[model samples]
Target: MNKQELIDAVAASTGESKASTGEGEGEALDAILEAVTSAVTRGEAVQLIAFGSFSTGACSERTGRNPSTGETITIPAAKTVKFTAGNSFKDAVNAA
Candidate 1:
């Protein structure tokens, strides 16, 4: 689901209003997201038990062929976010 949908779901689950969750200032869900994003952007890892972990990863620069023109192109190195699901999350998905 999208951001609004997620916010709605969390608000519902916590018996809070949508405005309280993320629509207004000092929103709880938004704060949580911001914390996670800030941590990841700093090359730090964020791990939530029974959910997953988010960490930074890297990709080396390399040469690749362009599918359209079949011409060689240089791909620059970049940082990436990685997520590894915990056992509980994996079990839930598998069960579903």
Candidate 2:
């Protein structure tokens, strides 16, 4: 589901009124997401029990070929985000 749908669901579950402009749960969700994003951007990990962990990883520079021209090119290394699901989350998905 999209962000609005998620906000509606959270508001419903918590008995909060959902404003047209997404005031209550939407703001809370946005704050939570912002916190997670800020932490990850700083090369720190964020772990939520029964959900997942977000961490940073690296890709080394490598040579690759262009698909169209078949010409060799150097691919620069970059930082990446990684997520590993918690066992409870895995179990829930498997059960579903």
TM-score winner among the candidates? 1
Task: Give per-model TM-scores.
Answer: 0.94, 0.89
**Sequence-dependent TM-score of model 2:** 0.89
How far in Å is the alpha carbon of 48 misplaced in model 1?
Answer: 0.4
- The alpha-carbon deviation from the true structure for residue 81 of candidate 2, after best TM-score superposition, in angstroms, is 0.5
Candidate 1: clashing residue pairs, number: 0
RMSD of each: 0.9, 2.4
Runs with alpha carbons beyond 4 Å of true place in candidate 2: 19-26
lDDT per residue for candidate 1 within 1-96, as digits (tens), equals 998999999988999999999887989888999999999999899999999999999999999999999999999999989999999999999999
Local error of candidate 1 at 86, Å?
0.7
**TM-score for predicted model 1 compared with the true structure:** 0.94
* Residue-level error in angstroms, candidate 1, position 50: 0.7
Q: How many residue pairs clash (N, CA or C atoms closer than 3 angstroms) in each of the candidate models, in the order given?
A: 0, 0
